[model samples]
Target: MDTPDTPHVNKERIDTMEHLSAAIGVSRPTLSRYFQDPDNVSRTSRERIRKGLERVEYVPNFFATRMNRKSTGMIGVIIPYLNDLFFSRLLEAIERAAMDVGYTVITQCSHSDPAIEARAAETLMSMNVEGALVAPLGNHSDLDVHERLRSRLPFVMVDSRPDTMPEVDFVGTNHYHSTGLATEYLARVGGPPVFLAMPRVNFNAMERERAYIAKMEQLGLEPRIVGVEGVSGAGYFEAHGQAVLEREFSSGRLVASSILCVNDRVAIGALRAAATHGLEAGAMQRGGLRIAGHDDYPLCPYTVPSLTTVAQNVDAIGRTAVARLVESIRAEKSSGKQILKLFDGEMKIRESA
Candidate 1:
């Protein structure tokens, strides 16, 4: 029996990894691979090594290993906010894609603040990540942070990008064409829709708004933009939608028979508002307001009337972003050329509209 205060016991317990590897009946290199990433080792070897570690109470110093390695085999993913389902799903997809390539992922949230976004970028750079996929805060992001990152390693913008970074690579949904499809559908089936404008936060929202306006004008319907004042970020879309609709109902300003929301969350909020005003919302046959939204969120199917929306190709966006970054990493020299890839959205017509 070894006592806590015994120097002999301490020395015996603090065995080197080489000794542990022999004890576990595994080669030193196999044990090293397990320490770097358990998935790197075969299942049988991993289980044997894990049992050996438990028996000996031995652990590898990962921090020291990271410091010694020239490449960390890690990827950084940054998004504006995590509360939104759209972003959460996007992050999950990106992580899966990174893991498929034997790379680990670390994530940071900016909470839609420019200063916080800059800090996140700096932290990722400091960690010496092999590459990064970012969904910038558009006009609000710090240009200096992006420039510094681009000069150091491969970087790809997902979902959105800053207007200043013209040379950066981007992977995003085709907001213009997607919005046009939704707007045109609403006009063909029901009445021309009144557009619900999101807070001018990201380029995605701006492009959606522009598409809605153009589509309306093309259809020969006067475009009406309804916006909520003094609201931004996270739950802002839903809250703003509710507030605006409530005011419009009371003042009888909601003239259109159909409404097109910027995204599914806003459409959900609009549904709640419509219910409060004792107005059922769905197809025209249901004697309710016809409503449609973009970016079919995960919960859209379960909504009251089953929301009609444009489904963004989040999986494609995630896979493409990771592949592009990996390609850049393998390149001997940075091309300094820009690549913009946009996948079209599919319109899902359900009970709503």
Candidate 2:
């Protein structure tokens, strides 16, 4: 049943309905109607369409055939850093899930910059992305950009939280509870000495800080919360971060065996600082100081004597974010208020505490 004008003979390219209508002498519209929800059409016509479909290869242009007139078969996924394993793993999962459903995924990195994040969102919107899955830089993100996109494109926040963008769905860890676990682990193993935090501007980090303070108070320990001063991006291997860690290391009052970090990178920097002062970061029984981190990075296990940390389900976060965004796009409505989808983060006890 080869049509002279058929573009390709692949199983997916066949115009089964058209070919069957031509062969069985049925109108194209009636044949089309029969193909879409066969129960709605006459039993005889449905049977004929089914037989025709089986005889010839064909796949509907789901982008065109979907009941929703607006879905574009494309989704935009944005993450804070593409190089970070947590974000990268999440993106890979999202990309895989999107491809499985025949949806194209366009990924971008905000580089933890607000302007860049805004530009990236605008770019995706201009391309007419059906939906977006963003792991924003939290406070660094431009709320206006998100607001505009929320008005038109379906979007979800993954792995990060803004102040309160009610228009978008949020999928991430419950930092407050997760950080409490981190604190409790520290109290049980090393005792809480200092909790390293970044700017209070980040909603998630703020939650973690509050959890740390609350846990410290509960355990009747003096909470020494240290904020890494300077720019927001400085938390990531910036010179200011080194200086901050240096000061922490130099402060002789920090008697706590383990220091809780905002994230893996911050812990890494602090660990390096401790090492510079000839302090070993490992189990006390093994004759070394203890350090603990959050968001177990890929290199955590490789850090000298290994780094103990909290591990979030990065892959699950990405998969769920994409699935949720796709559903919102298909639903053609964002009225479903921002859902705080929190996945439990587990503590990986290792050499460091």
Candidate 3:
């Protein structure tokens, strides 16, 4: 994100569609239909509207238009954080899908605060959004707000969902499948691995941990989880991973030859901890400790020795969420089903494992 050094124009815009219709010799209904969807009008009308829009420097007043309509063609999205690469990619996918359906997206970031999340939901409601796609705060979230969102609009939870509100529609990664896939691969290629966990922050963390333990026990290996509980999952995961592994290393009790980190950030932290201890992380054939994680983060492949992880189907999640939400919006109701729409995670084998 950089500022544009060169400053340019002070152009005037035609605010109301009525004035634009008069200026462009197009009917007001044609202008409205065109703005809603260019295909809604005839080919000749679309061409005329396109050229007319350029001629008048037209900019539709979204707020004013929304005020006059029962359906605003807008969707609200609330996420936990913006700095995480996974979420950033997910947002782009959602934006593209919404655009394809001729809907605008209004996004809000809670910054890991439940109060902020509730406020974001309220703000979206006040904006008169037709539907919402939310990533709730899990145990820390305001269940009342989620209940209200579910009761009122076409709401679908994405990525993470609150434990209490199981009734809401959800779309996210299938943690059991992903964890089992990664754990089994590590067990076959190397040895049974110890799980390095994240804090008990959200549903994803808890689900991943549970899945890892289940997989380990299924393989007849003891499940060992190394993590600090009740800590914040706001940010700085690498620091958390490094601190935990460093302490384990110093005590001389870290005997595991293979480690499965919760996420790539924690695995990156593990790499730092290994470097400090003069240990190497790579494939087992090289006589190195094998380390792997989930969530093929954008920077994982660039890390030292690279990182083997699972890649979430971000596009599928976004597209499915929007499609279902739109269906609910048009139907004026939810499907009233609690079944979570889960997408599979793909295995990404790198030098690390």
| Top candidate when judged by TM-score against the true structure | 3
Compose the digit string of candidate 2's lDDT tens values, residues 207-305: 788878888898899988776455444545423334566776688634336778888877778777777777777665444357788888889999875
Relative to the true structure, candidate 2 reaches a TM of: 0.76
Q: Which scores greater on lDDT, model 1 or model 2?
A: 1
Candidate 1 has what TM-score? 0.85
Q: Is candidate 1 or candidate 2 better by TM-score?
A: 1
Worst 10 residues of 3 by lDDT: 228-237
Q: Global CA lDDT of candidate 2, please? A: 0.74
* TM-score to native of every candidate shown: 0.85, 0.76, 0.86
Q: Please report, in order, the local distance difference test score of every candidate based on alpha carbons.
A: 0.83, 0.74, 0.84
How do the residues 1-353 of candidate 1 rate in per-residue lDDT, one tens digit apiece?
Answer: 65678644332353576787777789987877777778989999989987776666675765555655667878888898888999998998898998898777889999888899889999999888899888987776887888888787799999976677767999999888999999999888877788888768668788899999988898899988887353343357788777778777777666347899988888888888888877767775555478888998999999988899999999999989998998888789877778899999999998878
Model 2: residues with Cα > 4 Å off, grouped in runs: 1-70, 231-241, 285-288, 332-337
Clashes of each: 0, 0, 0
Task: Sort every candidate by TM-score, greatest first.
Answer: 3, 1, 2
Candidate 3 local lDDT, 1-353, one digit each (tens): 34588655544478788888888889998888787668989999999888876656777777777656768989999998887898898999999999999899999998888999999999999999999999887688888888888777888999987677777788999999998899999888877788888778768878999999999999999888888462344245787778777777778755346788888888899888877987678775455478888989999899887899999999999999999888888874445665579988999999888
Candidate 3 structure, TM-score to reference: 0.86
